[model samples]
Target: MGFRAMVCHRFSKLVLLSAAFISLVVNAAPWPDGAKIAVTLTFDLDAETIWWNDADTMTGNPGSLSYGTYGPKVAVPKILALLEKHDVRATFFIPSWVAEQYPDAVRSIAAAGHEIGAHGVRHVSPLQLTPEQEAATFSESVRVLDRIAGKRPVGYRAPSWAVSNATLKLAARAGFLYSSNMMDADDPYIHNDPPGLVELPVSWVLDDAPYFWFDEDSWNKTIHSAASVKAIWQEEFEAAYHGSGYLNLTMHPQIIGRPARLLMLDEFIGWMKRHEGVWLTTGSAVAVYVRGQQGRSP
Candidate 1:
Protein backbone atom coordinates (compact mmCIF):
# COMPACT_ATOMS: atom_id res chain seq x y z
CA MET A 1 0.00 0.00 0.00
CA GLY A 2 2.40 2.57 -1.25
CA PHE A 3 1.09 4.61 -4.10
CA ARG A 4 2.33 7.54 -2.14
CA ALA A 5 0.76 6.13 0.99
CA MET A 6 -2.43 5.29 -0.89
CA VAL A 7 -2.76 8.81 -2.21
CA CYS A 8 -2.50 10.29 1.23
CA HIS A 9 -5.37 8.20 2.54
CA ARG A 10 -7.61 9.17 -0.30
CA PHE A 11 -7.00 12.83 0.30
CA SER A 12 -8.12 12.72 3.88
CA LYS A 13 -11.32 10.98 2.91
CA LEU A 14 -12.20 13.67 0.43
CA VAL A 15 -11.84 16.38 2.99
CA LEU A 16 -14.17 14.71 5.42
CA LEU A 17 -16.83 14.14 2.83
CA SER A 18 -16.77 17.74 1.75
CA ALA A 19 -17.24 18.92 5.27
CA ALA A 20 -20.24 16.71 5.76
CA PHE A 21 -22.02 17.91 2.66
CA ILE A 22 -21.50 21.53 3.52
CA SER A 23 -23.05 20.84 6.91
CA LEU A 24 -26.07 19.29 5.30
CA VAL A 25 -26.78 22.18 3.01
CA VAL A 26 -26.31 24.68 5.81
CA ASN A 27 -28.79 22.93 8.08
CA ALA A 28 -31.27 22.38 5.32
CA ALA A 29 -32.11 25.85 4.13
CA PRO A 30 -32.89 27.73 7.30
CA TRP A 31 -35.60 29.87 5.76
CA PRO A 32 -35.91 33.50 4.75
CA ASP A 33 -36.49 34.63 1.20
CA GLY A 34 -35.62 31.17 0.01
CA ALA A 35 -37.98 29.75 2.57
CA LYS A 36 -38.91 26.09 2.98
CA ILE A 37 -41.20 26.16 6.03
CA ALA A 38 -41.42 28.36 9.14
CA VAL A 39 -45.03 29.25 9.94
CA THR A 40 -46.05 30.76 13.31
CA LEU A 41 -49.65 31.65 14.05
CA THR A 42 -49.34 31.96 17.80
CA PHE A 43 -51.74 33.42 20.35
CA ASP A 44 -52.17 33.09 24.08
CA LEU A 45 -54.30 36.10 25.02
CA ASP A 46 -55.22 34.21 28.24
CA ALA A 47 -58.00 36.49 29.31
CA GLU A 48 -59.54 36.50 32.77
CA THR A 49 -56.04 35.77 33.80
CA ILE A 50 -56.60 32.15 32.89
CA TRP A 51 -58.95 31.76 35.80
CA TRP A 52 -57.05 33.60 38.45
CA ASN A 53 -53.90 31.52 37.94
CA ASP A 54 -54.60 28.93 40.65
CA ALA A 55 -56.71 28.44 43.64
CA ASP A 56 -56.40 24.79 42.90
CA THR A 57 -57.38 25.53 39.32
CA MET A 58 -59.80 28.21 40.39
CA THR A 59 -63.41 27.68 39.42
CA GLY A 60 -64.91 30.39 41.54
CA ASN A 61 -67.74 29.96 39.11
CA PRO A 62 -69.16 33.19 37.90
CA GLY A 63 -69.83 30.76 35.13
CA SER A 64 -66.19 30.09 35.60
CA LEU A 65 -65.37 33.73 35.36
CA SER A 66 -67.44 34.14 32.26
CA TYR A 67 -65.14 31.57 30.74
CA GLY A 68 -62.40 34.07 31.04
CA THR A 69 -64.64 36.82 29.84
CA TYR A 70 -65.07 35.08 26.55
CA GLY A 71 -61.59 36.04 25.64
CA PRO A 72 -61.54 39.78 25.43
CA LYS A 73 -65.28 40.08 25.55
CA VAL A 74 -66.28 37.83 22.69
CA ALA A 75 -63.26 36.18 21.30
CA VAL A 76 -60.95 38.98 20.31
CA PRO A 77 -63.17 40.48 17.71
CA LYS A 78 -63.51 37.10 16.12
CA ILE A 79 -59.83 36.57 16.31
CA LEU A 80 -59.24 39.93 14.79
CA ALA A 81 -61.39 39.32 11.83
CA LEU A 82 -59.67 36.06 11.11
CA LEU A 83 -56.31 37.66 11.14
CA GLU A 84 -57.51 40.42 8.92
CA LYS A 85 -58.75 37.93 6.42
CA HIS A 86 -55.43 36.21 6.30
CA ASP A 87 -53.18 39.08 5.54
CA VAL A 88 -51.50 37.25 8.40
CA ARG A 89 -48.92 38.54 10.81
CA ALA A 90 -49.70 36.67 13.97
CA THR A 91 -48.27 36.35 17.51
CA PHE A 92 -50.12 37.61 20.55
CA PHE A 93 -48.93 36.27 23.99
CA ILE A 94 -50.26 38.83 26.53
CA PRO A 95 -51.07 38.39 30.20
CA SER A 96 -50.07 41.61 31.74
CA TRP A 97 -53.39 40.98 33.43
CA VAL A 98 -54.66 40.25 30.00
CA ALA A 99 -53.14 43.50 28.95
CA GLU A 100 -54.64 45.31 31.89
CA GLN A 101 -58.07 43.85 31.35
CA TYR A 102 -58.38 44.22 27.64
CA PRO A 103 -56.86 47.58 26.96
CA ASP A 104 -59.09 47.95 23.98
CA ALA A 105 -58.55 44.31 23.22
CA VAL A 106 -54.89 44.68 23.81
CA ARG A 107 -54.89 47.74 21.65
CA SER A 108 -56.55 45.89 18.87
CA ILE A 109 -53.88 43.24 18.96
CA ALA A 110 -51.33 45.94 18.67
CA ALA A 111 -53.14 47.76 15.96
CA ALA A 112 -53.37 44.62 13.86
CA GLY A 113 -49.76 44.34 13.02
CA HIS A 114 -49.42 41.66 15.71
CA GLU A 115 -46.45 40.36 17.78
CA ILE A 116 -46.78 41.15 21.50
CA GLY A 117 -45.24 38.27 23.53
CA ALA A 118 -44.74 38.36 27.37
CA HIS A 119 -47.46 36.19 28.89
CA GLY A 120 -47.22 36.59 32.64
CA VAL A 121 -48.31 38.89 35.34
CA ARG A 122 -51.22 36.80 36.49
CA HIS A 123 -51.45 33.76 34.33
CA VAL A 124 -48.95 32.80 37.01
CA SER A 125 -47.07 29.49 36.72
CA PRO A 126 -43.51 30.41 36.83
CA LEU A 127 -43.86 27.15 38.63
CA GLN A 128 -45.31 28.99 41.59
CA LEU A 129 -43.08 32.00 41.53
CA THR A 130 -40.34 33.09 43.88
CA PRO A 131 -37.10 33.74 42.23
CA GLU A 132 -38.03 36.98 43.78
CA GLN A 133 -41.49 36.19 42.58
CA GLU A 134 -40.23 35.36 39.18
CA ALA A 135 -38.25 38.53 39.07
CA ALA A 136 -41.27 40.57 39.94
CA THR A 137 -43.12 38.82 37.24
CA PHE A 138 -40.63 39.89 34.67
CA SER A 139 -40.59 43.43 35.79
CA GLU A 140 -44.31 43.70 35.92
CA SER A 141 -44.43 42.04 32.58
CA VAL A 142 -42.29 44.66 31.00
CA ARG A 143 -44.06 47.49 32.69
CA VAL A 144 -47.46 46.28 31.75
CA LEU A 145 -46.72 45.45 28.16
CA ASP A 146 -44.95 48.72 27.74
CA ARG A 147 -47.75 50.81 29.10
CA ILE A 148 -50.44 48.98 27.23
CA ALA A 149 -48.82 47.59 24.15
CA GLY A 150 -47.09 50.60 22.86
CA LYS A 151 -44.24 48.28 21.94
CA ARG A 152 -41.71 46.66 24.28
CA PRO A 153 -42.10 42.93 24.24
CA VAL A 154 -39.58 41.02 22.31
CA GLY A 155 -40.98 37.66 23.47
CA TYR A 156 -41.62 35.32 26.46
CA ARG A 157 -44.39 32.78 26.82
CA ALA A 158 -44.23 30.80 30.03
CA PRO A 159 -47.36 30.94 32.15
CA SER A 160 -48.27 27.27 31.73
CA TRP A 161 -45.39 26.43 29.55
CA ALA A 162 -44.11 26.43 33.11
CA VAL A 163 -40.38 26.97 33.13
CA SER A 164 -38.57 27.50 36.41
CA ASN A 165 -35.09 26.14 36.65
CA ALA A 166 -34.39 29.80 36.44
CA THR A 167 -36.67 30.21 33.54
CA LEU A 168 -34.07 30.65 30.86
CA LYS A 169 -32.08 32.84 33.15
CA LEU A 170 -35.15 34.89 33.94
CA ALA A 171 -35.82 35.26 30.29
CA ALA A 172 -32.37 36.55 29.68
CA ARG A 173 -32.76 39.06 32.45
CA ALA A 174 -36.18 40.27 31.49
CA GLY A 175 -35.28 41.34 27.99
CA PHE A 176 -36.22 38.33 26.02
CA LEU A 177 -35.38 38.02 22.37
CA TYR A 178 -36.99 34.61 22.27
CA SER A 179 -38.50 31.87 24.42
CA SER A 180 -41.77 30.43 23.25
CA ASN A 181 -41.75 28.46 26.46
CA MET A 182 -39.89 25.56 24.91
CA MET A 183 -40.93 22.08 23.87
CA ASP A 184 -37.38 21.16 22.96
CA ALA A 185 -36.85 21.41 19.18
CA ASP A 186 -38.13 21.36 15.70
CA ASP A 187 -35.52 23.98 15.02
CA PRO A 188 -34.31 27.29 16.48
CA TYR A 189 -31.85 26.86 19.33
CA ILE A 190 -29.32 29.04 21.05
CA HIS A 191 -29.14 28.88 24.80
CA ASN A 192 -25.81 27.89 26.14
CA ASP A 193 -27.36 27.97 29.59
CA PRO A 194 -28.34 31.57 29.12
CA PRO A 195 -25.87 32.71 26.62
CA GLY A 196 -27.57 34.83 23.95
CA LEU A 197 -31.11 33.35 24.20
CA VAL A 198 -33.44 32.26 21.39
CA GLU A 199 -35.59 29.13 21.58
CA LEU A 200 -38.91 29.46 19.66
CA PRO A 201 -40.25 26.02 20.35
CA VAL A 202 -43.65 24.76 21.42
CA SER A 203 -46.00 21.89 20.91
CA TRP A 204 -48.86 19.94 22.41
CA VAL A 205 -49.61 18.42 19.10
CA LEU A 206 -49.44 21.88 17.56
CA ASP A 207 -51.68 23.05 20.41
CA ASP A 208 -55.26 24.14 20.26
CA ALA A 209 -55.37 23.77 23.99
CA PRO A 210 -55.45 19.98 23.92
CA TYR A 211 -58.00 19.76 21.17
CA PHE A 212 -60.19 22.71 21.95
CA TRP A 213 -60.61 23.28 25.67
CA PHE A 214 -63.93 23.55 27.41
CA ASP A 215 -64.72 23.44 31.06
CA GLU A 216 -67.30 23.12 33.70
CA ASP A 217 -64.36 22.18 35.79
CA SER A 218 -62.64 20.29 33.04
CA TRP A 219 -65.34 18.01 31.74
CA ASN A 220 -62.85 15.52 30.47
CA LYS A 221 -62.24 17.45 27.26
CA THR A 222 -64.09 16.01 24.32
CA ILE A 223 -65.36 18.80 22.09
CA HIS A 224 -62.87 18.27 19.33
CA SER A 225 -64.01 18.38 15.70
CA ALA A 226 -63.15 21.38 13.75
CA ALA A 227 -62.94 18.80 11.08
CA SER A 228 -60.90 16.84 13.51
CA VAL A 229 -58.79 19.76 14.47
CA LYS A 230 -58.18 20.73 10.93
CA ALA A 231 -57.02 17.23 10.32
CA ILE A 232 -54.51 17.55 13.04
CA TRP A 233 -53.34 20.88 11.74
CA GLN A 234 -53.07 19.66 8.23
CA GLU A 235 -50.89 16.82 9.36
CA GLU A 236 -48.60 19.13 11.21
CA PHE A 237 -48.33 21.39 8.25
CA GLU A 238 -47.51 18.55 5.94
CA ALA A 239 -44.80 17.38 8.22
CA ALA A 240 -43.36 20.85 8.35
CA TYR A 241 -43.61 21.09 4.64
CA HIS A 242 -41.50 18.04 4.07
CA GLY A 243 -38.97 18.66 6.77
CA SER A 244 -37.84 22.20 6.53
CA GLY A 245 -39.43 22.08 10.01
CA TYR A 246 -40.99 24.53 12.49
CA LEU A 247 -44.75 24.93 12.87
CA ASN A 248 -45.26 26.55 16.33
CA LEU A 249 -49.01 27.07 16.64
CA THR A 250 -50.52 27.52 20.08
CA MET A 251 -53.90 29.16 20.17
CA HIS A 252 -56.49 30.46 22.58
CA PRO A 253 -58.66 33.47 22.61
CA GLN A 254 -61.11 31.57 24.70
CA ILE A 255 -60.32 28.44 22.77
CA ILE A 256 -59.76 29.16 19.13
CA GLY A 257 -62.36 31.91 19.18
CA ARG A 258 -65.12 29.39 18.63
CA PRO A 259 -67.24 29.82 15.55
CA ALA A 260 -66.66 26.28 14.66
CA ARG A 261 -63.19 26.92 15.90
CA LEU A 262 -62.86 30.01 13.76
CA LEU A 263 -63.92 28.08 10.74
CA MET A 264 -61.24 25.57 11.53
CA LEU A 265 -58.83 28.43 11.50
CA ASP A 266 -60.13 29.63 8.24
CA GLU A 267 -59.70 26.33 6.52
CA PHE A 268 -56.31 25.98 8.06
CA ILE A 269 -55.27 29.21 6.45
CA GLY A 270 -56.27 27.89 3.11
CA TRP A 271 -54.21 24.79 3.70
CA MET A 272 -51.20 26.89 4.50
CA LYS A 273 -51.86 29.03 1.50
CA ARG A 274 -51.12 26.26 -0.92
CA HIS A 275 -47.64 25.91 0.39
CA GLU A 276 -44.42 26.57 -1.49
CA GLY A 277 -41.48 27.17 0.73
CA VAL A 278 -43.83 28.56 3.37
CA TRP A 279 -42.49 31.17 5.79
CA LEU A 280 -45.74 32.60 7.07
CA THR A 281 -44.02 34.21 10.02
CA THR A 282 -44.28 36.08 13.33
CA GLY A 283 -42.97 34.90 16.66
CA SER A 284 -40.94 37.98 16.37
CA ALA A 285 -40.37 37.12 12.79
CA VAL A 286 -39.21 33.69 13.80
CA ALA A 287 -36.99 35.23 16.38
CA VAL A 288 -35.47 37.64 14.00
CA TYR A 289 -34.88 34.90 11.51
CA VAL A 290 -33.32 32.75 14.17
CA ARG A 291 -31.08 35.57 15.13
CA GLY A 292 -30.10 36.32 11.62
CA GLN A 293 -29.27 32.68 10.97
CA GLN A 294 -27.27 32.35 14.14
CA GLY A 295 -24.90 35.20 13.81
CA ARG A 296 -26.86 36.45 16.84
CA SER A 297 -27.45 39.88 18.29
CA PRO A 298 -30.69 41.09 19.88
Candidate 2:
Protein backbone atom coordinates (compact mmCIF):
# COMPACT_ATOMS: atom_id res chain seq x y z
CA MET A 1 0.00 0.00 0.00
CA GLY A 2 1.07 3.59 -0.57
CA PHE A 3 2.48 5.40 2.50
CA ARG A 4 -0.23 8.13 2.28
CA ALA A 5 -3.07 5.56 2.17
CA MET A 6 -1.56 3.56 5.08
CA VAL A 7 -1.25 6.72 7.21
CA CYS A 8 -4.86 7.74 6.56
CA HIS A 9 -6.19 4.25 7.40
CA ARG A 10 -4.25 4.24 10.69
CA PHE A 11 -5.60 7.69 11.54
CA SER A 12 -9.21 6.56 11.00
CA LYS A 13 -8.69 3.48 13.19
CA LEU A 14 -7.26 5.64 15.98
CA VAL A 15 -10.25 7.99 15.84
CA LEU A 16 -12.72 5.12 16.14
CA LEU A 17 -10.85 3.56 19.08
CA SER A 18 -10.70 6.91 20.87
CA ALA A 19 -14.43 7.45 20.45
CA ALA A 20 -15.21 3.99 21.83
CA PHE A 21 -13.01 4.56 24.86
CA ILE A 22 -14.64 7.94 25.49
CA SER A 23 -18.09 6.34 25.40
CA LEU A 24 -17.07 3.72 27.94
CA VAL A 25 -15.65 6.38 30.23
CA VAL A 26 -18.88 8.37 30.01
CA ASN A 27 -21.09 5.35 30.69
CA ALA A 28 -18.94 4.20 33.59
CA ALA A 29 -18.57 7.62 35.17
CA PRO A 30 -18.57 7.84 38.96
CA TRP A 31 -21.78 8.49 40.90
CA PRO A 32 -22.43 11.41 43.26
CA ASP A 33 -19.46 12.72 45.25
CA GLY A 34 -17.24 10.60 43.02
CA ALA A 35 -18.59 7.30 44.30
CA LYS A 36 -17.38 4.53 42.00
CA ILE A 37 -20.40 2.28 42.49
CA ALA A 38 -23.64 1.98 44.45
CA VAL A 39 -24.24 -1.07 46.62
CA THR A 40 -27.70 -1.99 47.97
CA LEU A 41 -28.73 -4.88 50.16
CA THR A 42 -32.37 -5.95 49.56
CA PHE A 43 -34.33 -8.67 51.30
CA ASP A 44 -37.61 -10.32 50.43
CA LEU A 45 -39.13 -11.48 53.74
CA ASP A 46 -41.60 -13.99 52.32
CA ALA A 47 -41.82 -15.90 55.60
CA GLU A 48 -44.52 -18.56 56.19
CA THR A 49 -46.87 -16.93 53.77
CA ILE A 50 -44.75 -18.26 50.89
CA TRP A 51 -45.67 -21.80 51.83
CA TRP A 52 -48.89 -21.69 53.88
CA ASN A 53 -50.73 -19.92 51.09
CA ASP A 54 -49.50 -22.26 48.37
CA ALA A 55 -52.09 -25.02 48.56
CA ASP A 56 -50.43 -27.09 45.87
CA THR A 57 -47.09 -27.37 47.66
CA MET A 58 -47.79 -26.52 51.29
CA THR A 59 -51.37 -27.66 51.71
CA GLY A 60 -51.96 -30.21 54.46
CA ASN A 61 -48.24 -30.02 55.28
CA PRO A 62 -48.77 -27.89 58.34
CA GLY A 63 -45.18 -28.42 59.41
CA SER A 64 -44.01 -26.25 56.53
CA LEU A 65 -45.56 -23.23 58.16
CA SER A 66 -43.27 -23.60 61.15
CA TYR A 67 -40.34 -23.88 58.81
CA GLY A 68 -41.26 -20.61 57.12
CA THR A 69 -42.01 -18.86 60.39
CA TYR A 70 -38.29 -18.69 61.10
CA GLY A 71 -38.11 -15.61 58.93
CA PRO A 72 -40.05 -13.22 61.14
CA LYS A 73 -39.89 -15.21 64.37
CA VAL A 74 -36.11 -15.54 64.50
CA ALA A 75 -34.25 -14.62 61.36
CA VAL A 76 -35.32 -10.98 61.03
CA PRO A 77 -33.80 -9.69 64.24
CA LYS A 78 -30.49 -11.31 63.43
CA ILE A 79 -30.45 -9.70 60.00
CA LEU A 80 -31.42 -6.33 61.40
CA ALA A 81 -28.84 -6.33 64.15
CA LEU A 82 -26.18 -7.17 61.60
CA LEU A 83 -27.22 -4.34 59.32
CA GLU A 84 -27.42 -1.90 62.20
CA LYS A 85 -23.99 -2.87 63.37
CA HIS A 86 -22.62 -2.36 59.90
CA ASP A 87 -24.33 1.05 59.65
CA VAL A 88 -25.78 0.00 56.31
CA ARG A 89 -29.28 0.81 55.06
CA ALA A 90 -31.25 -1.81 53.17
CA THR A 91 -34.59 -2.31 51.41
CA PHE A 92 -37.12 -4.89 52.56
CA PHE A 93 -39.93 -6.12 50.30
CA ILE A 94 -42.81 -7.61 52.25
CA PRO A 95 -45.88 -9.55 51.22
CA SER A 96 -49.02 -7.87 52.58
CA TRP A 97 -50.33 -10.81 54.61
CA VAL A 98 -46.99 -11.23 56.39
CA ALA A 99 -47.00 -7.58 57.33
CA GLU A 100 -50.64 -7.77 58.44
CA GLN A 101 -50.04 -10.82 60.64
CA TYR A 102 -46.61 -9.69 61.80
CA PRO A 103 -47.05 -5.95 61.92
CA ASP A 104 -44.65 -5.65 64.80
CA ALA A 105 -41.97 -7.48 62.87
CA VAL A 106 -42.45 -5.41 59.78
CA ARG A 107 -42.63 -2.29 61.90
CA SER A 108 -39.28 -3.13 63.44
CA ILE A 109 -37.68 -3.24 60.00
CA ALA A 110 -39.27 0.08 59.08
CA ALA A 111 -38.27 1.58 62.39
CA ALA A 112 -34.64 0.88 61.62
CA GLY A 113 -34.72 3.50 58.87
CA HIS A 114 -34.72 0.94 56.05
CA GLU A 115 -36.82 1.31 52.91
CA ILE A 116 -39.88 -0.98 52.66
CA GLY A 117 -41.16 -1.98 49.21
CA ALA A 118 -44.27 -4.00 48.36
CA HIS A 119 -43.80 -7.68 47.52
CA GLY A 120 -47.50 -8.39 46.76
CA VAL A 121 -50.50 -9.75 48.67
CA ARG A 122 -50.35 -13.43 49.70
CA HIS A 123 -47.07 -13.79 47.81
CA VAL A 124 -48.88 -14.25 44.51
CA SER A 125 -47.08 -13.79 41.23
CA PRO A 126 -48.29 -11.15 38.79
CA LEU A 127 -47.79 -13.72 36.02
CA GLN A 128 -50.56 -15.81 37.58
CA LEU A 129 -53.04 -12.94 37.59
CA THR A 130 -54.88 -11.29 34.77
CA PRO A 131 -53.49 -7.86 33.98
CA GLU A 132 -56.48 -6.29 35.68
CA GLN A 133 -56.09 -8.57 38.66
CA GLU A 134 -52.40 -7.78 38.94
CA ALA A 135 -53.11 -4.07 38.82
CA ALA A 136 -55.80 -4.39 41.49
CA THR A 137 -53.52 -6.49 43.68
CA PHE A 138 -50.72 -3.98 43.33
CA SER A 139 -52.98 -1.01 44.17
CA GLU A 140 -54.51 -2.70 47.21
CA SER A 141 -51.11 -3.92 48.36
CA VAL A 142 -49.73 -0.40 48.19
CA ARG A 143 -52.62 0.74 50.37
CA VAL A 144 -52.24 -2.02 52.97
CA LEU A 145 -48.47 -1.80 53.19
CA ASP A 146 -48.72 1.97 53.51
CA ARG A 147 -51.19 1.65 56.37
CA ILE A 148 -49.10 -0.93 58.20
CA ALA A 149 -45.71 0.60 57.54
CA GLY A 150 -47.05 4.17 57.86
CA LYS A 151 -45.36 5.28 54.64
CA ARG A 152 -46.47 5.11 51.05
CA PRO A 153 -44.03 2.66 49.52
CA VAL A 154 -42.62 3.99 46.27
CA GLY A 155 -41.17 0.69 45.11
CA TYR A 156 -42.60 -2.75 44.14
CA ARG A 157 -41.01 -6.10 43.28
CA ALA A 158 -43.16 -8.86 41.82
CA PRO A 159 -43.49 -11.83 44.15
CA SER A 160 -41.12 -13.69 41.84
CA TRP A 161 -38.46 -11.77 39.93
CA ALA A 162 -40.22 -12.44 36.63
CA VAL A 163 -42.65 -9.78 35.41
CA SER A 164 -44.81 -9.24 32.35
CA ASN A 165 -44.86 -6.00 30.38
CA ALA A 166 -48.20 -5.23 31.97
CA THR A 167 -46.57 -5.37 35.40
CA LEU A 168 -44.41 -2.38 34.58
CA LYS A 169 -47.31 -0.13 33.49
CA LEU A 170 -49.49 -1.33 36.35
CA ALA A 171 -46.76 -0.70 38.92
CA ALA A 172 -46.15 2.79 37.56
CA ARG A 173 -49.88 3.49 37.57
CA ALA A 174 -50.11 2.24 41.13
CA GLY A 175 -47.69 4.97 42.27
CA PHE A 176 -44.43 3.04 42.28
CA LEU A 177 -41.23 4.90 41.55
CA TYR A 178 -39.24 1.77 40.63
CA SER A 179 -39.49 -1.97 39.91
CA SER A 180 -36.76 -4.50 40.81
CA ASN A 181 -38.18 -7.44 38.88
CA MET A 182 -36.30 -6.91 35.64
CA MET A 183 -32.68 -7.94 34.94
CA ASP A 184 -31.94 -6.08 31.73
CA ALA A 185 -28.68 -4.66 33.04
CA ASP A 186 -26.34 -4.55 36.01
CA ASP A 187 -26.95 -0.84 36.42
CA PRO A 188 -30.31 0.89 36.93
CA TYR A 189 -32.25 2.57 34.16
CA ILE A 190 -35.56 4.23 33.38
CA HIS A 191 -38.22 1.85 32.07
CA ASN A 192 -39.60 2.82 28.69
CA ASP A 193 -43.15 2.77 30.02
CA PRO A 194 -44.92 6.07 30.53
CA PRO A 195 -43.57 8.22 33.35
CA GLY A 196 -40.44 6.05 32.99
CA LEU A 197 -40.13 4.44 36.42
CA VAL A 198 -36.61 3.51 37.47
CA GLU A 199 -35.63 -0.10 36.79
CA LEU A 200 -33.36 -1.53 39.52
CA PRO A 201 -32.29 -4.85 38.07
CA VAL A 202 -32.01 -8.16 40.01
CA SER A 203 -30.32 -11.44 39.15
CA TRP A 204 -30.52 -14.94 40.61
CA VAL A 205 -26.77 -15.09 41.18
CA LEU A 206 -27.13 -12.01 43.38
CA ASP A 207 -30.02 -13.48 45.40
CA ASP A 208 -29.68 -15.49 48.63
CA ALA A 209 -32.52 -17.96 48.00
CA PRO A 210 -30.88 -19.92 45.21
CA TYR A 211 -27.69 -20.25 47.18
CA PHE A 212 -28.93 -20.81 50.74
CA TRP A 213 -32.52 -22.11 50.72
CA PHE A 214 -32.75 -25.89 51.11
CA ASP A 215 -35.55 -28.43 50.88
CA GLU A 216 -35.43 -31.90 52.44
CA ASP A 217 -39.03 -33.01 52.51
CA SER A 218 -39.76 -32.55 48.84
CA TRP A 219 -37.13 -31.43 46.39
CA ASN A 220 -34.32 -32.24 48.82
CA LYS A 221 -32.03 -29.60 47.41
CA THR A 222 -29.20 -27.78 49.15
CA ILE A 223 -27.19 -24.80 47.95
CA HIS A 224 -23.62 -23.57 47.99
CA SER A 225 -21.56 -23.22 51.15
CA ALA A 226 -21.20 -19.93 53.02
CA ALA A 227 -17.56 -19.66 51.97
CA SER A 228 -18.53 -19.98 48.33
CA VAL A 229 -21.22 -17.33 48.66
CA LYS A 230 -18.87 -14.87 50.32
CA ALA A 231 -16.18 -15.44 47.72
CA ILE A 232 -18.53 -15.09 44.73
CA TRP A 233 -20.11 -11.93 46.13
CA GLN A 234 -16.72 -10.35 46.70
CA GLU A 235 -15.67 -11.21 43.19
CA GLU A 236 -18.83 -9.60 41.81
CA PHE A 237 -18.33 -6.49 43.93
CA GLU A 238 -14.78 -6.03 42.69
CA ALA A 239 -15.87 -6.24 39.06
CA ALA A 240 -18.73 -3.78 39.57
CA TYR A 241 -16.59 -1.40 41.55
CA HIS A 242 -14.03 -1.17 38.79
CA GLY A 243 -16.70 -0.73 36.13
CA SER A 244 -18.29 1.97 38.27
CA GLY A 245 -21.69 0.28 38.04
CA TYR A 246 -24.41 -0.53 40.55
CA LEU A 247 -24.48 -3.70 42.63
CA ASN A 248 -27.80 -4.88 44.13
CA LEU A 249 -27.37 -7.90 46.41
CA THR A 250 -30.69 -9.61 47.13
CA MET A 251 -30.81 -11.42 50.46
CA HIS A 252 -33.48 -13.22 52.49
CA PRO A 253 -34.03 -13.23 56.22
CA GLN A 254 -35.07 -16.86 56.13
CA ILE A 255 -32.08 -17.86 54.06
CA ILE A 256 -29.07 -15.64 54.59
CA GLY A 257 -30.04 -14.92 58.20
CA ARG A 258 -28.74 -18.27 59.44
CA PRO A 259 -25.90 -17.68 61.89
CA ALA A 260 -23.17 -18.95 59.56
CA ARG A 261 -24.70 -17.25 56.54
CA LEU A 262 -25.11 -14.04 58.52
CA LEU A 263 -21.45 -14.16 59.42
CA MET A 264 -20.63 -14.58 55.76
CA LEU A 265 -22.87 -11.62 55.06
CA ASP A 266 -21.02 -9.57 57.64
CA GLU A 267 -17.75 -10.52 56.06
CA PHE A 268 -19.02 -9.35 52.69
CA ILE A 269 -20.15 -6.02 54.15
CA GLY A 270 -16.84 -5.54 55.91
CA TRP A 271 -15.08 -6.10 52.62
CA MET A 272 -17.35 -3.49 51.02
CA LYS A 273 -16.74 -0.94 53.78
CA ARG A 274 -13.02 -1.17 53.34
CA HIS A 275 -13.39 -0.40 49.66
CA GLU A 276 -13.42 3.29 48.82
CA GLY A 277 -15.96 5.03 46.53
CA VAL A 278 -18.88 2.72 47.24
CA TRP A 279 -22.18 4.53 47.92
CA LEU A 280 -24.43 2.27 49.97
CA THR A 281 -28.17 2.97 49.97
CA THR A 282 -31.61 1.47 49.45
CA GLY A 283 -33.28 0.67 46.10
CA SER A 284 -35.66 3.64 46.31
CA ALA A 285 -32.85 6.01 47.14
CA VAL A 286 -30.97 4.67 44.15
CA ALA A 287 -33.99 5.36 41.98
CA VAL A 288 -34.23 8.93 43.17
CA TYR A 289 -30.55 9.52 42.54
CA VAL A 290 -30.68 7.89 39.10
CA ARG A 291 -33.64 10.05 38.16
CA GLY A 292 -31.70 13.11 39.15
CA GLN A 293 -28.81 11.70 37.16
CA GLN A 294 -31.00 11.57 34.08
CA GLY A 295 -32.10 15.15 34.56
CA ARG A 296 -28.57 16.47 34.92
CA SER A 297 -27.21 14.80 31.79
CA PRO A 298 -27.07 17.15 28.83
**Candidate number achieving the greatest TM-score relative to the actual structure:** 2
| Model 1 misplaced regions, further than 4 Å | 1-28, 31-35, 40-49, 53-59, 65-123, 131-157, 160-165, 169-179, 182-187, 195-198, 201-247, 271-273, 279-298
| Tens digits of lDDT, candidate 1, 1-298 | 1111000010111111132333111232246676667789988988776665364464455766777789888988888888888888899898787788679988988898888889888787888878888888888988999999898998898987999988889889887888888775566665655766778778899888888776557588777788988988899888777763678898988888878888889889877888876778698887776655543211
Question: What is the per-residue lDDT of model 2 for residues 1-298, given as tens digits with 9 covering 90 to 100?
Answer: 1111000110111111132333111222246677778898999988876666563364535676776788899999998899999999999999887888899988999999999999988777777889988888787888888999999999888887758758888888888999998765677766545455888888888888888777755776777899998888888998887763678988878888788999999889988989987888999888887766553322
TM-score of each: 0.34, 0.87
Q: Which runs of model 2 end up more than 4 angstroms from their true locations?
A: 1-29, 53-60, 217-220
**TM-score (C-alpha, index-matched) for candidate 2:** 0.87
